[model samples]
Target: MSKRDYYEVLGVAKGASERDIKKAYKKLAMKYHPDRAQGDKSLEEKFREVQEAYEILSDERKRAAYDQYGHAGVDPNRGGGAGAADFGDIFGDVFGDIFGGGRGRQSRARQGSDLRYNLEMSLEEAVRGKEVEIRVPTLVECDTCHGSGAKKGSSPTTCPTCKGNGQVQMRQGFFAVQQTCPTCSGKGKIISDPCNPCRGQGRVEKTKTLSVKVPPGVDTGDRIRLSGEGEAGEQGAPAGDLYVQVHVRDHHIFTRDGNNLYCEVPLGFTTAALGGEIEVPTLDGKVKLKITPETQTGKMFRLRGKGVKSVRSGAVGDLMCKVEIETPVNLSSKQKELLEEFEATCTGQGAKHRPKEKGFFDGVKQFFDDLKS
Candidate 1:
């Protein structure tokens, strides 16, 4: 098929100036835009023709060639056509002001990324709080190049492809895409003579030993931030922060809830039956807990201000101790005889000594009587 003339395709005269050509192209592009056309094959074909015609006429070199020699001068088969018009570029350049976001935004030296380190501590250490030392592998700025990424006494040069904008426009027929400059990797600069220690990245890996002071009562899922302790930035940019994620280990004897601590204390059956004082373990020390007569299992006792302190409110919590009456595991013959005799004394006592047991059977008896009725 015969190709249309570039001037005729854009509805412009042969003597049209660059500004006039650009204005005509913008109007035609908006009208024939694939988004506006909604998959209309004829509009898409017209858009392609408009794109090809504007591509040839928009540049001085291609336009001059086409004006002198027609389609043969700007043919890709003949090693011509350096690509002047792009779909996204038309919107970016012509309709950018109407829709916002057409300006080129360049980046400077890129900052380092933030880092996280999981720190595990014992419950005692988390409750009482202690200073802990940790080793973290991270990137530090190179001393030889002073974070410039260039060799000593030399400096980085601006990227030639992106012109220090750290971005480049790529075109594929009607499609246009903006991407990071491959030459500088979005740093806007290139190091011709990279530092020997850190190569071209401007930072080197090293293990840093840091001391973290844990506040009193920092529980699991708590975080401690260390400012400027993360990886060093590229090309002398500012460093990011390091977060220490705390996980308190489970204790053998104690479980914590919010600002309180809960523990189960085993009480001797004799001590539960007769009132007595027993020493129980606490984070502070052994504390005496008084057991009242007829104390039952699952009975909870509170020790005021003996638990973990609140890191946020500065209030001390109470320690809740649940007593579980322990039955005798191994019994001597004499102990078994004595227990039998003691049971015989309470055999006809009804609810006097065992109120719960008597009440349970009374309810069971009433349930059977109702069934009979």
Candidate 2:
């Protein structure tokens, strides 16, 4: 029986690109696969036919020869025993993901994983910056074997089972299954005389002391990176980095937002009623803030350049001090009498000195009148 055209079997035009042919074959393969269409002989035969069609049409040279002289030109039975080119193309498409059996061997020397250390700092320390010492547990190179995993004079030997391939393949019913070598566990070598210090591993677990310089104006959530301070990799691979994550402690006197500092300053009634200068605390030192006459509670005063300078940029921010007027407590009888006399004199002025209180009373009266109506 004459064979069908390869392109027509795969349902692709002769001028179709390699990608188009692969796409059409993949759809047919998925649809007619024996696993998907169980016990269906017709579908299984269709799957094999599509696979054979793709095997010929997907190759440039074989496709050209077949296009010129038909199937007889490139047939394996025609004295040209299955071409090396055709075998490689089929194997690559089928089993490329199996073990280290691909084109190149996988790299043995892998870098270590990055580590994070939470560091809590006082607000003052975070704002001013300081050198902090942190102890981190990490893997360091073994002193005895110097990261070779071998004894003083001896070294590791190639695995007897896999012969340094680092992988072993097993034939499983029409498919080759590749897995890590059981003897070497994929290392491809075995150490006969292991180091006593690190025991067959090239690294030792120990606490490492690192000095990290915290930059000025670093707020919470800022991280400082210390290069090559993390765990050491196996067989002299490159070490990972150490990240110091900052956490600023709550301050009793101040709260910070970005570069700005905010604080509440309590003032006596006399200082709020009759203007006075009071001392306010800043990161640098104490600064005097002037309060004008009749200063009310919740009044804010800004002192320029008294806040922290940003670490990202050197721009300084202002300190905002909010005033909270303190009423007199523990008053004597004489003080109470004197306050009453002063209140009486103020009442005689008829709400002129207390415009806010007078407006509040006016609103209250209007509300009651509207309710009665």
Candidate 3:
């Protein structure tokens, strides 16, 4: 008898995907299986033909040979097809795909989740670095059961439902499928006597205090990672990590931009007119700031190497100070008279001493003259 084409027997196209071939084979196998056929000889013969077709077509080497030479390429009678052991391997793979495992298989364990903690630090502490303690509430491994979830002097036993396989196979109509054991919950073990503290959970919620060392020049949004400091894993698995997020508090004296520091320095009126050395505050200490004669308000002075030194690159930044001249207030009668006489002498000198004030009045006079015209 001439054998039919494998694709024709399976009722699938020659260019069909592996998945399509498997699907067609499964449907035909279900219809012609000997158990479903109930001892009918013809149906049993058809079942054998279907099995043979699947065995040859499912194998890459055999399928390739069969595609080129037809039935002569894979003749089971001529010892060219798969042997009994090879057939067993094929059956194992197909059955495993349909009804899951038949041998020993380990269940997957869960790992702990990572955690985050926000840390607030003062400007001085952020620039200089400091060690701080933080309290975190998380799950910790139970000591009574040693993370086994079993009571003292007791241990977990193999689940009778799955027989320690952690999975159970069920026959459904024409297909068999495997699922996690309901009784064991896929753990493959049963804890009859649970621990008193964790009550079979193997872990407990507790608050832990840990010390975190903040590095110098750590800006806001910087994170310090601490390994194995997060929540405890299930059944003594590996612990997760803890990330400490840094947040620097605002400074009252200076505003920091990257590594540079900016501040407003109040300059006395006499100092602005006559010019002299004034003391200015820096991160290191006070520095003498020399003011030029007739220095105007809002004049900026740059003091190099007086700002923050970068922790990453170790580069020094400058401190920029803006001068704001303060006007005299609460003058006595004699002081006011002396100021009026000094002002009169200064105005008599024209725009020599007060060029800015003279320019402002000159612009106003031009504006009125233009409006009259």
Taking every candidate in turn, the Cα RMSD to the unseen true structure, in Å, is: 23.0, 21.5, 24.6
The candidate, 1 or 2, that scores higher on TM-score is: 1
The TM-score of candidate 1 is 0.71
Error of 2 at 181 (Å): 4.1
Tens digit of lDDT per residue, candidate 3, span 1-373? Answer: 7777888898988878766776676567657765568889999898677766766777678787787767766764333444445456445634775644655455543456657786777778888889999999988889888788889999888889988877777777767666778998877888999999999878899999999998788765456889989877776777777878666666789877767889999999999999999999987789999999889999999999887777789887899999999998999999999999988888666689878888999999999999999
Instruction: Give the candidate number with the greatest lDDT.
Output: 1
Residue-level lDDT tens digits of model 2 in 166-208 = 7776667667656668998867788999988899888999998
lDDT of 2 at 206: 94
Q: For model 1, how does the per-residue alpha-carbon lDDT over 1-373 read when each residue is reduced to its tens digit?
A: 9998989999999889876776677567657766668979999999778766776787688898788777766766432442334224434644454444556647587667767776778989999899989999999999888888899988898889899988777666655556778998877888898889999778999999999999989975566889989889878988877878666766899988778899999999999988799998889999998888989999999999989999889999999999998898889999999999999999999799999999999999999999999
**After superposition, candidate 1 runs with Cα above 4 Å error:** 1-101, 170-177, 368-373
Better of 2 and 3 by lDDT: 2
lDDT scores for all predictions? Answer: 0.81, 0.79, 0.78
Which pairs clash (backbone N, Cα, C closer than 3 Å) in model 3?
A: none
Model 3 segments beyond 4 Å from truth? 1-107, 155-190, 348-351, 358-373
> In model 3, how many backbone clashes occur?
0
Model 3, residue 39: C-alpha shift (Å): 81
